[model samples]
Target: LVPPDILKKMYVLRRILNPMGTVDAIEFLLGKLRETKVNAEFFEKMNT
Candidate 1:
């Protein structure tokens, strides 16, 4: 598993790679995570 520091860096990288996390291929995954109570609204507003 990635260490916390590394994981944070990876998450940052992911934001840079897809700032909105709205990639067509991952919308369902995002919705599922949201259903599980994960707070992903930050991603929705990242474009701003």
Candidate 2:
């Protein structure tokens, strides 16, 4: 497996290669993850 540092550099290079698309993709994933976390927390609170 690739080392974490090399993997990070590869991601940076990919972002540099396609800046707008990369940013948009990252934002979309972050938003989806945030929504999932909020929903999970809401359910957990309800279960308590």
Q: Which candidate wins on lDDT?
A: 2
Across 11-44, the per-residue lDDT of candidate 1 in tens digits comes to: 7646655755557537744654465543444333
lDDT of 1: 0.52
lDDT of each: 0.52, 0.54
- Summarize candidate 2's per-residue lDDT along 1-48 as a digit string, tens digits: 975655665576455457457778788556655655574443333322
Total backbone clashes of model 2?
0
Ten contiguous residues minimizing lDDT sum, candidate 2: 39-48
TM-score per model over all chains = 0.37, 0.37
Question: Judged by lDDT against the true structure, how good is candidate 2?
Answer: 0.54
Error of 1 at 36 (Å): 37
**Model 1 steric clash pairs:** none
